[model samples]
Target chain A: MGRRILFITTDQQRFDALGCNGGTVARTPVIDSLARDGINYTRAHPQNVVCMPSRSTMVTGQHVATHGVWMNGVALPEDAPSIALTLRQAGYRTALVGKAHFEPLLDPFLRFAENRMGRDGTHSEMFTMPDGSVVPHRGFDHMEFAGHGAAGNLHYVGWLRSEHPEVMGKFVPNLDGDLEVTTEPGGDTMAPQVRTTNDVPRGWYHTEWVADRTIAWLDSMGQDDDWFCWMSFPDPHHPWDPPQSELHRVDWRDLDLPAGYIADHEEREKVLASKPAHWMGWYDGSFVSNYEAPLKWVPATLQPDQVREINAMVHVKNELIDEAVGRVLASLRARGWDDDVDIVFTTDHGEMQGDFGLLFKGPYHVDSLMRLPLIWRPAKSAGIAPATVTAPVGHVSLAATFASIAGLPRPDYTEAPALPVNDDDARERGFERVLTEWDSVLFGKEVGVRTIFRDNWTCSAMLPGTLHDGTEGELYDHANDPLQRVNRWDDPSVRSLRDDMLADMWDHLPSVVSPRRTCDAPV
Target chain B: MAYIRRDIHIARTPAEVWGFLGEPARLHEWFPISGCRVEGTKRWIDLPTGITFEEDIHLVDNHQRRFVYSIVNNMLIKDHFGILDVVDDGHGHSIVTYSTQCTPNVLALVTAGAAGQGLAKAKRILEGGN
Candidate 1:
């Protein structure tokens, strides 16, 4: 029998958002404890910065190019090889208990049906078998779809209707829409806006609901049956809305301004000018014409106080998630499965958290949005000692790592290596460099960016445009400037190093373009 | 509350337009569902995602060239009803109108997009003789 695998992911969490990871303001003791007991990969980076592609890579062990979910609107193919399917084949009962952004919430087919049907029932039946068991979509035997908003959240919305109808009434109209309510606009293009606070009660919050449902699922599992569960939480992501009860967990007065950020416009302009033109345009509101206007949350201006308040709300959301994780962990222990379960804790992608004068993520591949916290805690009997690894690993390796941990044969389609769990010299095992890609498909921009993180240098270049425009690239010497305030792509001294990194990135590109598929395809 | 209305000019008589739109089986052809199963006035629409939804027919008036239906027992919507009307344009052409009323105003955009697409498909098939 294999150990039960508990794969937990939070949305839009930063690498340094945990207290154990040196987050000064975040109160994440539960997640911090996971790092204390597990192997923490300090330099883990996601293959893509957005939600869909990054999550797709985590499950399929394929890059964005191979998976073809270059942006959020695209869906991961149901036939794609997944870790959940591989584990199910190994006799493990697989279940996903939270947000699976594999499919677009507003897909034309789903929207049309919902409009015609007048009711959005638990769409889980779509993924169910004739015997009433779930027909695994990408390998998970059961799915509890609690998406970000009530508009498309099947499970969470059902719970809300049954439990807290009043709260549902207030949130449903604006469900899944932009969470940020502009209370006070930034006077200029560099200031942040003061946003509204979250109003849901602590008990009815999605974070608590996800945890409660996950614990219930675990309790239902047989004593001898091994299970694989992905407990995904949708919070600490956006809307920056933390429940009123959880808001006091972190005080806004105690918060500090983001590192690598100063209020000086000239200094910020100098930093933004050194990178891609679209980034600066996003910051200054010039790029709104090029992309979907409503989806753009990046404000042209932000005040220091607004940024601090947003950070405070983010910390509160993090603490709430930590509390939820603690409950799930307690449930596992109560079932006497603590010693027989392997736990993997990570996020879909990193949040800027006001880093580098930026609040949300965009075309830029800065470390704040690219780097993620990767922690693995093997069962006590696995004989893997706890230690922090500094090697550069990509989220693309997670599917392979899950297979290796479950004692299954490696899937043939994956290009990622199994995570180095027991190896003391994991960094020396050729896990030195990671390639990150950004296809401007979502924003409808003409530029595509690819970045390589090797050694202490991060090199990024815009495809097609970088060849003609000298300024369309960025090179950061992270060793000297950890905050990445300086761009050295044009620096005469590191030209050779940049070229080598670019060649490595080109070498890792997919040889053939993989076609995208709908999630409803027959297996 | 959200309201969505889509009107298309089809090169067919009002009776011909209502004949195709009123029949549940013909409705499935122009609607986005891959297939549908009908039990009296209730239809179980099968989507590409494999999920099926139940739509109850509230009224079907052939003389008025109007059909009315409502989606019942749905979680995401409240007081949701749809109406499809066909009127003669006096030029041997018919003007087809599809309208919906639902709560949670954001769904209006979704309903509008889907209705526009469905109507466009119906116009193409009717005019192109497909």
Candidate 2:
């Protein structure tokens, strides 16, 4: 019988963000336990750095480019064979509960909820609700909206904040009001619940409650039969709202500013002129100098206040999510599935809350948005334990790994092959020689986005056409300057490394669609 | 130094309020938008060191708990003034106050709604007596 796989995914989580991965404040006891018991792959990449593309890659094991879903307008093709389909075909009953952004709001996925029209149309970018909450595009199966005030946009993936209070499953009034705030958007992102009474949830909260339902589902399933489940959380994303005690854990004054918190006025102007997209909001399309952007959006120059609020939100949400994970694991053990399943923890993308003086996830290939949290554990008794695969691995490989874990074969139609899940020694043995290539961020099939990563070497391509060998590329030895705060694009010493890497880039670019690349390769 | 304050409240103790007028140096405490600061002269506050912001004393009312001040680099703030008064109705006392009279700049005009949160938050914090 195939081993059951329990995949736990969180929203906007960065890879090296846990205590196990050197994070100073992040509390991920459950994840840490999994790492101690099993493998802790240090190098894992998301298919894309944005929610839509990254998730599409995760669901189908296809690159963002191949998945064909970009920002809001793009949609995943219906015919695309998903991981669920493959696992279902292999007799592994699969259930996806929570933020799988790629799941269609219509048809099969849409059938899971009552408010299908509002949910599907919003995600597809075709939903037309005049004068509704302008933030359309909430990417979840079951959505209980809280804060959106009728502009008809699913701008945020939050719960009806008013109801979230109840969904939280706990409350402490003596707590600071901010601590009580749930990222679920109790009222609207901007306005809060006047009477904490509205903070209650009526069964539509997608965060904690989602885990509750997910746990319940696992219990009802047959123990002897194998099952595959993907549980995703919507936070630590934004409005940085979480139940009080959780939100209060991190004071607003405690948030560490992101390196790229705010861009220079010139750069800010350039991005604003382009009117870059945001998670639940956006900058005015006009050119805006760094000074003009709101303090909340610019982490670099966050007003002393925004820094506090943002940190409070992120810190608390992380704790809440950690708690949720604990609940899932405890339930799994109780249901007798703990010893027979593999739990994969991950996230869709990372949020640049206020990095680069920018408000949302921008089109940058930097590690901030690229590196995503990923951890996997096999049941202790299963004896299928493998060492942490440290070689740089992509999200696409996960599909094949899932298939391989379930004793199924790699799908014949894929651009990339399945990465080996051999024992730790084997992974270590192959690290140096493994195929390591970071795909360029595709701004669609038209533009060439940069790709950088490797021990200390970084590469940037102008895209569409270029080679590091004078065609047009930038290289930096990040060993000395980790921030990549400096650019040695013009530095002369590392020309040879650039030459070799550039050649590798040219060879790496597939002439046409491989039918293999998923969402431009993630963290 | 032009920001928008969508609503207006005028209080009597403008001068006394200035004594405790919110400052920019420790901004994260009162404002909902400001939360944490890691590095800077106006760094994030904690139990050891609290959040504070320096306000350019714009206006003051001593009799009432009210004052107007601006952060150092103010663009999104036009003029913010608060009006407050504590009243005694024989048996007990009550407080009435108006909050956040700053005008938002052009950029603030769009996402300024987050500031409305500031007004409501300010009122509760100041008058809640705790």
Tens digit per residue, CA lDDT, model 2, A501-521: 666655653343344322211
| Residue B79 displacement in candidate 2 (angstroms) | 34
The candidate that achieves the highest DockQ relative to the unseen native structure:
1
What tens digits encode model 1's per-residue C-alpha lDDT throughout A1-523?
Answer: 6789999999889887888888888778888888888899988899988788888898889988898877654566556667887888789998887777775556536642222221354333334433454545667767776655455436787778777877764332322232212223321122233233446778888899899989988988999899999999987776565566666677776777878565687788888877767767767766632222223355545667767777877788788889999999999999989888999999988876666666767667887888888899988878888888888888988988888888886788788878886435665568878988876432123457888999878999877642225346889989898988888888889999989988998897674354432222100
- Candidate 1 CAPRI category: incorrect
Which parts of model 2 are misplaced by more than 4 Å?
Answer: A70-72, A103-205, A255-301, A353-359, A382-386, A419-448, A464-474, A511-523, B1-130
Candidate maximizing TM-score: 1
Docking class of 2: incorrect
Residues B1-130, model 2: lDDT tens digits: 2233344232423332234333434334444433445333333322111224334444444544444443444333344443323333333433333333333322222222333334445545555632
